[model samples]
Target: MSLLFYSCNSQKKAQKKEAETHKVIQKKYADLLNVSTTEIKNVRLYAFIEEWTGTPYKYGGLSKSGIDCSGFCNVLYNQVYQKELPRTTKDIAKQLDKVKQSRLEEGDLVLFNIEGKKNAHVGVYLQNNMFVHASTSKGVIISSLENPYYKKAYNKGGKV
Candidate 1:
């Protein structure tokens, strides 16, 4: 059977205005089989995860010049994702649903307790078990979920 080939601009426009970014259809795989429309909204979220790379880390500030952990995620929500989020790490954590580690997705929010407390640090998830945040010691960067420091101090995550 032959399926109709369709490309949509309206779909792209609404998606661009939402929390997630792009929907990727692999030509390599789609050539072999039919590709569904909402293939992976979860995957689309990962696109914005790398947006803050190289942004400087700051305290009580939010911008490319510098960004705190929660500020970094906040800026991402306001600008790139065109969504609004709470300001502080504590508030942001409270705004999201507490989910299991096994259910984590690309756009899911990841919280860490760098000081062994609760809701002290936050990050936005990237692809392949990676996330981006403004490090207190370093600038904004991507890191692995299994990173020793984050792994031990992890709190909980939720959808932004």
Candidate 2:
């Protein structure tokens, strides 16, 4: 009986800690994205992206100081999903099961043809069609997959 009571108590404490952590994560991401926490459906993804927000884009760079679209995608997958992904946009695309644009979900990889080449750019899909990527012209930023620019370059969404 004592062991049962202790286990139940420990479980409750763990649940409380998780709830608090989630609340804090939501608040941080909501403030960073200028939206309500309710708007964020994937707390892990949002928080991860928030950490790298505003970092400069650099070719062949991998750290916060500078990172390219593919590098960002690679790190995000490894850190958030605990999966290893290819380091280049093209190779990363190959690792994914192709998903239609209309069927995309959070954690999907959105591939693009920004340089008139397939899979030239990549970003991680967030809720409401938004994706985070490191852009050569804009550094790290969140953009809508529906934006005219992205729509024009949009290739497909990928899920590993």
Candidate 3:
């Protein structure tokens, strides 16, 4: 009887620890994204972003040391949503259903036309017009779609 009681207590403690950890993660991302903790519905997604944040940008690199826009999006999608995406931004864009910027939702793909080339850049939309991407200059960072450069280069939103 004592052993059974101890086992139950241990299980309860484990669950409590897990819940606390989840709250911490949610609070961290809520602050980073400038949203309320309740607005962060996907803890796994935020955790993944936190893990890869600040990774260096590389043209075709795929590892932690360096990753490109498409590579980052692909890794994110595959891990978070269990969806496999094409390697190139153009190819990934081709597979998506076009969506207007105003209709974008969480997990949507944001394509950009840089330097007059269509679909030259890509990012994973998070929420509140914020998206995560591997920028050529800033590496992996979260950016707002309202930024002047992104606004001008915005091509279209893509939904899988």
Best by lDDT: 3
- Give per-residue CA lDDT, model 3, range 48-95, as digits (tens): 898999999999999899999999999999999999999999998899
Alpha-carbon RMSD to native, per candidate: 8.6, 4.5, 2.0
The local lDDT score (0 to 100) that residue 16 gets in candidate 3 is 100
User: How many steric overlaps are in each model, in order?
Assistant: 0, 0, 0
TM-score of 2: 0.79
Ten residues in sequence with the least summed lDDT for candidate 1: 25-34
Best by TM-score: 3
- Superposing every Cα of model 2 onto the true structure, what RMSD results? 4.5
* TM-score, per-candidate, Cα-based: 0.68, 0.79, 0.89
Where model 3 places Cα greater than 4 Å from the true spot, the runs are: 1-14
Deviation in Å, model 3, residue 81 alpha carbon? 0.3
Tens-digit lDDT track of model 1 for 72-127: 88877776678889999889988898778778765678998876678899998644
In model 2, which runs have C-alpha deviations exceeding 4 angstroms? 1-21, 24-41
* Inter-residue clash pairs, candidate 2: none
lDDT of each: 0.71, 0.86, 0.93
